[model samples]
Target: MQSANLQKQKLELIEKIIHTDDQNTLDFLKSILNDETSDYELTDEQKQIVEEATAKYYSGEEPSFTWDEVKNNIRKRNFQD
Candidate 1:
């Protein structure tokens, strides 16, 4: 396809996404948002943290937390004075 045609198609799709209230459309958008690449563009400090976590993971010395524990920690953090 030509570049202009592809751009036009992309714009139409984006307009549909913006205007539609359908459940499936919302779910599809959610899946796109949940993609790892779609999440925050990591800062240098965040990149370092991820690298350290990966090394610890490979070393078998990493700490593990359950989803509930993580959620609880987040809740506590949000409520902190």
Candidate 2:
């Protein structure tokens, strides 16, 4: 109930902000909105890394762990401290 009220307040404030003629405020808001929805494009190096990893996985050259093994490993590490 409290969260709903907060969300409503935020929407009202954003609606007010969207109508302002202030350039600086508008630019700041544009940046915030852009950051929220920005799609990150992978660089050539990053693409190459991903492709190599995929190849290794498909070739079974990369080691894989089952869920049970992972849980056991985590339990062991937690008790080691």
Candidate 3:
């Protein structure tokens, strides 16, 4: 099928779906349209962080923290009555 025809079909289908399931269809459309491609551009710091994580994973040197360690840290932060 041609791209134009496909787009028209999609629009018609979306309209029908919206009419039948207004809230869900609106939410789906909102989610689809809310994506700001430009805003998702990664910063230099984020890029470096991703690179570091990738390097750690590839080098088999990723740091591992246990659940007990997390619980202990959180417990220490709590003040007992």
**lDDT against true structure, model 3:** 0.79
Q: On a 0 to 100 scale, what is the lDDT of residue 68 in model 2?
A: 100
Clashing pairs in 2: none
Name the candidate that leads on TM-score. Answer: 2
Which residues of candidate 2, in runs, are more than 4 Å off? 1-38, 66-68
Q: Rank the candidates by TM-score, best first.
A: 2, 3, 1
| lDDT string, candidate 1, 1-81, tens digits | 579989999999889988998997788678888863444488999999999999998888987789999999999999994
Model 1: lDDT of residue 67:
100
Which lDDT value does model 2 have at 54? 90
- Weakest ten-residue segment in model 1 by summed lDDT: 31-40
lDDT by residue for model 2 over 1-81, one digit each (tens)? 579889999999889997898997887788887876645699999999999999998999998889999999999999998
True-vs-predicted CA distance for residue 36, candidate 2, Å? 9.2
lDDT of 3 at 54: 91
TM-score of 2: 0.43
